[model samples]
Target chain A: MTSPPAVRLTALTRRFGEVEAVRGLDLTVDRGEIVAFLGPNGAGKTTTLDCVLGLSQPTSGAVEVLGLPPREAVARGLVAAVMQTGGLLKDLTVGETVRYVGSLFGHADRSSAVLEEAGIADLAGRRVGLCSGGEQQRLRFAIALLSDPALLLLDEPTTGMDVEGRRAFWAAIRRDAARGRTILFATHYLEEADQHADRIVLISHGRVVADGTGAEVRALAGGRSVRATVPGLDETLLGRLRALPTVDRVEARGEQVHVHAGDSDLVARHLLTATDAHDVEITSRNLEDAFLSLTQEAR
Target chain B: MSTPTHPADAYDPAGRTPPRWGGFNRTLLGLELRRMLRNRRTIVFTILLPAGLFLSFGSTGQASDRVGSGNVAAYIMVSMGLYGAALTAAASGAMVAMERSLGWSRQLRLTPLHPAAYVVTKTLVALAIGAIAIVAVNVTGLLQGRPDMPAGTWVACAAVTLVSTLTFAALGVFAGYLVPGENVMQILGPGLALLSFLGGVFIPLDVGSTIWHIAVLTPMYGVAEVARAPLTHELPWYAVVNAVGWLLAFVAGAAWQMSRDTARV
Candidate 1:
């Protein structure tokens, strides 16, 4: 038997006067899964999340969280959200904020445990507004986890964080996922999605353009690039490199000539035999390339 | 093999069922009350401001003159109390506007708490604050050689204060919602104060002309009239009806606007 979805949106649409913020967006998140929602600013990512959280009603669609409406699910303590601003009471201490949120879910001790888990136990007595942005983010994460919610809705979970902070944050998210909590997060950070998401859903212009694994979405770019830095290169060799069947495009910058090809290894092997080709370094196509290609294709 | 389910999981501990009054409303009320109490300035303004005004106004006339005649001291005491009520109403409106401007209301809206709870909580906070202000004013008046009005009048005043607070709180909420953040106080504070003064909170209705008569048609006038009736024993039926009507109108208008706001979000 298949487990029920943590959240499901069927043709969800939200209109703000003449402008349609979210249009016919259908999506689902299952228990114990991490789904990343990728979209540019004003692409209905937040609106969709708001709808699933029951903060906003769909203009013409239905949304369910843990087999109930979003508001019902929230009352039942089945869903928790970590919004962009963290939504914490500024005057309250960290512990107080967590306890307040936990009390709403009928669990007080859970707040402390969640706080410790989020690595902010020492700052429990500190006021939330006095804390740094990263600290506030962690506090929100702790609060979101206080209810032991089955589903977590995180919007831009780590937008402004140092490299190490983001890694630690991702570790906490992974820990939560390990405990069987389904997470659906919207973020512009492609690397976070690529590294942590079990599945990614790309939204643009108030619609879902792509939904698949990191590798699957990357495959949407068709082929990979064979970027090589040759110590010495000539136009004859560049022309010869571009003539390769696997090579789609070629650009020469000074002594280094970069090649976009279906097979990087084959291109590198052919480049090694060239008279002026020396010290050729081939790299894999990253998510940036895939994202640019996908967004371009979407447009 | 046995499937394990936690004891807390078997039964909904938080009473997962939709509350008769709704959790959102309760939570909203809870948060609003806590926030209001937490602010030292708000507490001082809500409780002390009216009390001080009433005491200063009440002490001007000797206690013997205030006994049966219900002279200017008693009259001004009632008016000052009404002024406090108006201030409370204006403050409540400003508070809501400030909360919205600071994004606190939006944050609360994202919670599982129901929308009705949010509205009800805010209304209750305003009412509670208004009651505190009214009590402070009357208690101070009593201490300043002004004897208490009859229990019946006191109860009537309390009831009036409650209804007036509700009506003004609703108006405040509407103002907060409608007014832009930067111009909230500029629009609501002076606007409410002007209405209150015109409605006879500052100047007596009998002293003013056709405009004051027109002002008596406002919600604040009705509230002031109802509040002063027990103390002065001069109940104006038309003013009471007008206040009740305005209160109902504010409620309807607020409900409509809130529903539209929520739907738009």
Candidate 2:
């Protein structure tokens, strides 16, 4: 028999007046794993995270974090969150904010170490409001880590961060995961999930439509791409390629002909022989393509 | 081959634990006291306002042989204490309101800090502010050589003032919680003004007939009646009991509303 997950949702449902923000959503995040929640704006990503953080109550069903009810887990200092807005006091210096939060969790020295680990040691004296968005995000992460919580929920953690900042943030998360912390993060940026998540759950219209490993979910897109730099690509050949049984879509840009099809290898061989196309390149489908395809298919 | 240890694994020392609360209320009270003292605006309004008003009132009776003239000077001195209580209550409410607006309360709710701790912190902060206001009022009044009220009267008056501040602070918290942010100032401004006037903070409760009777039934009126008994050497058992009762009711009501609100969120 398997042990229970670090975080689990059993048919969770939350309604706000007339609208259902989250509906009968079931998920489980195992210990020492990073699960990325993928969704667009107003897709109930934040709402679900709020439920997990005990910031919002589910209208029906139940949620458990670290084997306890969400609110109970929070009271026990078993859960931590890095919200999109950072949520640090503006008047307080970075060090002061960390210390204040640490005191709340009954840990003072742990905050300083978390700050150092997040690479914001030099920013201790700066007021939280004066720091840049990336700096504030790092500080929020540091504060969340102060309690050594069993579950960490990050809602759009890298929304405002630049590319480099995001890379560093993910690296930190990976480090934490390696030490047996469970992380459930939500992000609209598919690349973050693709690069980091052990499993990905895709939500739309307050429901989970896809849940699997990166490769498994990508397979839901059901096709690969074949890009060929053909010497002469004409509309007639493009039409012929588009008519093939395996082909999903066809695009012609300058000297290159890109084909979206079910089997790129099979399509590439046919394209090479049929159009005498050379310089063929076959690439695996990316998360962006998979997401668009999946969402479109759901619609 | 040995596995590479991650940065998070470096602190894998077993059996490390953090400290828990010794006495929950005392720790919360001490923290609240520190916060109140550190707040510059609270210090100014609580401490400075009382001193300023006392000086303005005390200087008038300094030249007169008859200290308790029951005129503007006496009225101002008494009113100064009432104002101090009102200001402390208002400041307490504003601080809690500001915390809610800034999401601090919601964040704090996630911690091991109990609901009682949060409420006690606010109450203690208000009490500390009230103490400062009372001391400033008495010191300024004494410096001006206004006939010193009896020590027993001062003690009675301070107790009533503290209770009144507590009651008003709870009401302020309720108002801050119920009212929307855009209309906070408008709601609190008119309501506080009316309480101050009707409760006899500025004008004596005996000025009107039917209106005076009705105003005396108000929470502030009960506060003022109890607070002034010590100064006037006219301690009324009914007034003190009523004031204490109202303070308890306000605290109970505010706590109920806040806890319900927190649970809903």
Top lDDT prediction, candidate number: 2
Q: Write the per-residue lDDT of candidate 2 for residues B1-265, one digit (tens) a residue.
A: 2135433233332223333651144444554566667667667777786778567655653434332323344445666777776776766776676667667776676566666656666777787778778777767766665535556656666776776777878777777777735355466656766877777776565645887767766677777776676555554565677677777886787677677766766
Q: In candidate 2, residue A37 scores what lDDT?
A: 95
lDDT values, one for every candidate: 0.72, 0.73
Give the worst 10-residue stretch by lDDT in candidate 1 chain A. A100-109
Off by over 4 Å in 2: A1-3, A162-164, A226-260, A269-283, B1-34, B60-79, B178-194, B205-211, B233-264
lDDT of 1 by residue, A232-297 (tens): 577778888888886789988897777888777778888776544776676666777777777667
Residue A4, model 1, lDDT: 50
Off by over 4 Å in 1: A10-26, A59-62, A106-109, A162-164, A227-259, A263-282, B1-21, B24-31, B62-72, B182-190
TM-score attained by chain A of model 2 = 0.83
How many pairs collide in each candidate, listed in order? 3, 0
